[model samples]
Target: MQNVFSEENIKIISQIDNWQKAVEIACQPLLEEKKITQKYVTNIIKSVKKYGPYMVLTDYFALMHAKPGEGVNQLAMSLLVVKEPIDLEGKKVKIFLILACPDSKSHIKTLKEVAGVLMDQCNFELILKGTKSQIIDLFQKKEMDGGKK
Candidate 1:
């Protein structure tokens, strides 16, 4: 789906180095799309950070096994888990594509229908045997394509 957050929000989220920042960045697009309110987004982020992926599983039945534990790893896992269909300002939001560190192939099967699923092994092998920048550049290109890539 097309990203709803403003470019400034996307930039702010992307520039930050922390997982919290990443979560904020991920949610910004949904907030702007009106698929979720700011309050809901904040709550989702907080819940995921504290309780893990279980936060959205009830709302999104497909996320039955999305619970991650604590800390940055959990936070990253939470972001990777919370995928739901949403309506943004009238448009129906379809997917939430996550790009992780390649080797962390924890939930590839769960995201079969969304879009790209980069397994850590596949990504790591490519980076070591091929070019690391290609993956990063792909993400950049996707972002530039407004999430359609």
Candidate 2:
């Protein structure tokens, strides 16, 4: 199994003033890689504002994204975590997994791998405190382990 995460696709932000900025910051890696544009980030925030905090995956985690095919150049992702939680309306989020994809189907495998980690508290905690390389290594190790329990 191969890891989708790398040093270039991850960020650990110390703080953010708002959820909109958080989504923008989380998508920065994708932006830098030319995988997505600023418009994609704006659409994501717009969707969240219209729909509410339905994307918050867990207590402190969120999956930030918009519908594919908007400004996505390819399937790519980034991880963003903050030192403290920020308000997304009523919910608080400190971790973000932002994704941009070439098509609707391309990111399923990626989401599956991410969901595997999200299901394991131990793994998620490691992600919370881990450095960029440590975070990438965790995903690689999990992939090599075949996501074993």
Winning candidate number (TM-score) = 2
Name model 1 segments beyond 4 Å from true: 1-17, 52-110, 123-149
Model 1: what TM-score? 0.33
TM-score of each: 0.33, 0.92
Cα lDDT for residue 46, model 2? 90
Model 1, 1-149: lDDT tens digits are 12212232222111333344444556554445444444544554565556654423222121212223221122122122222344322322222232221234543533431234233345323322333245445444545755443
lDDT of 1: 0.34
Query: Which runs of model 2 end up more than 4 angstroms from their true locations?
Result: 147-149
Query: For candidate 2, what is the TM-score?
Result: 0.92
| Candidate topping lDDT | 2
Please, what are the lDDT tens digits per residue for candidate 2 over residues 1-88?
A: 3567888778887888998888888888889989898889988999998999998978989988898889888888888888789999
